[model samples]
Target: MKKKIKLTVWMITISLLIAAVLFVLQQHSFSMTEQKIEIDTPQGQLTGTLVLPESYSGTVGLVVFVHGDGPVNDTYDDGYKPLWEKLASAGYASLSLNKPGIGGSSGNWLEQSMEDRAQETIYAINWAKALPMIDAQAIGLWGASQAGWVIPKIVKKVPDLAFSILVSPAIQWISQGQYNTRQEMILEGFSEKEIKKREDYNAQILLLLKEQASYESYLRIAQSDDLISKEKWGFFSKNYQSDASEDLKNFTTPVHLVLGGQDINVDVEETERIYREKIPKNLLSVFYLPDADHSMLSKKNASSPLRTYLTAVFFPRHIVVEQYLDDLVHFVSQF
Candidate 1:
């Protein structure tokens, strides 16, 4: 009788432990129906991930997430996992594609220009619209960093996109680079004169790029002793730039602009200037969060290197994830 009682107690304890583990796993794993689709673009065949909410019944609006310049990894499992999960919970199906040459996708990412990337997005948009579960008329674009450039290009091509959300978008690549260099100097405790010298050098480099100077010539100039700043300026000159604000003139889609006040990569002031002077008043929604750096995290101070480093590590700060998603839900609900 004693042996039987001990055995029963052990069995019950094991079952309880197993049940607890299963419950935790279930909570972590949100039910998201997924599909793998291939989008053929002018450049190459692009692979994309389409995630539908578990409780989704009828057709629902889809949100296509476009990654920045960096290689697109498993956003579903990594960086934007929370946002994707949040959107799924909110009844919005979200799709994110591995940029060409990244993840399981094909093609050479380096060889592709901005236009090529934009074409890829357009192809993905078409593919998403074809999904029976997706409401074709209620599609939206969410772009961050380099995708900012790509988003406007696609919108221009499609013209009738529902809306777009640009997070820390680079308005002008050249200006953004210049601003970043200056911000770095300020953080490093450079004097006013030193900062001015760096700005002048950056401006000259931009002028050279505008003139279609040879890559080698640009390199030589950038490395010249006259360029007082020690900062390297290679890729900045190579990147494509457009009059984003001017291109936005043709955009009828509503735009939600979220900027980190302490963002050092892109000039907050310049973004404000463009928003005020260029973007049409009726279509723009602006939100500037104080103490928030490029990643939207609350920092000890704007100039703290540690904060900057952390922001770089986690782009699109996680602290404001809830608010961002809430705003998005509200925005889409309004339309």
Candidate 2:
């Protein structure tokens, strides 16, 4: 009886081991090949990854990724790989560059203006166009959040680009900031009085930015523990007046504008309205994901820290709304 019990336990352990191995394989295995690539630009060397379909022959379409905000690496900590895999399955390759000061890249992203970022993206596009494996005619732009300001600048300069994908992009810097503050405060259950107070404070900060106040001058007024870093203040001061309306009018290529209903970061309604007003109907397509949030994560998953953590660990690829991925692949397939 003892020997029989021991044998049963051993069999169970082996089965569990096999299940774990399969899980790892399923998580890591993708229908794409990735290689580290470096590009030299006037600013510095950009460290990134070039992801391509595993079975593709000859040149394929390329999607150059522009990071939204913050210090993000090439794959956004692998958050981009799932989308990369999907694009690859649709016979498109993707190139993502690490933001300056992140992932060993030289220079500071905070020191750049929207036009500076646009110039960097143009350099990346030119570099990609020279690659033998990339179809220059099919190259497009995929930008999100803060990239909204950068993409329009690129569209104005790179007239031959195939397409542009704008995800949760904001239209104006100041108005977007106001909307974000109000919406997030309400979502967090802030009372009317508290929300008003925060808005008032934000107004003061905007004034300081407009006045070109030094960091020391800002400290005298802010008086809050959550102080802005000198770098952040510089970045905000440089870009506070950015508006995309003027640049949107210059778009000569097809654009796919993605908006999330649950996004509090950008006023999606305003974004949709202005894009419609500025861009011609024939060249514009809108995808509204009602159940997705700012980052395209499902509303439920984004609401809970515990659930988000678990889902990211066990099903990293499905962290974003599944439909969002489907729509992305579908859009790319059309080209």
Q: Best candidate, TM-score-wise?
A: 2
Candidate 2 structure quality by residue, lDDT tens digits, 261-283: 99999999999999999999999
Model 1, span 1-335: residue lDDT tens: 99999999999999999987786555445457776767776666777778888787889888888777666654634556556667777778888888767776887566566777778778888888888888888899988777767788888899888998888888887667777888888988999999998788777777876786666666676755645222233334345465476665656878888887778888877776786676688889887776667755565634466664554344433434346656667776755
Clashes of 1: 1
lDDT of 2: 0.92
Residue 315 in model 1: lDDT: 42
Candidate 2 minimal-lDDT segment of 10 residues: 21-30
User: Once model 1 is optimally superposed onto the true structure by TM-score, how far is the C-alpha of residue 20 displaced, in angstroms?
Assistant: 14
Task: State model 1's lDDT.
Answer: 0.72
TM-score of every model versus the real structure? 0.77, 0.95
- Cα error of candidate 1 at position 233, Å: 9.2
Q: Go through the candidates in order and give each one's C-alpha lDDT.
A: 0.72, 0.92
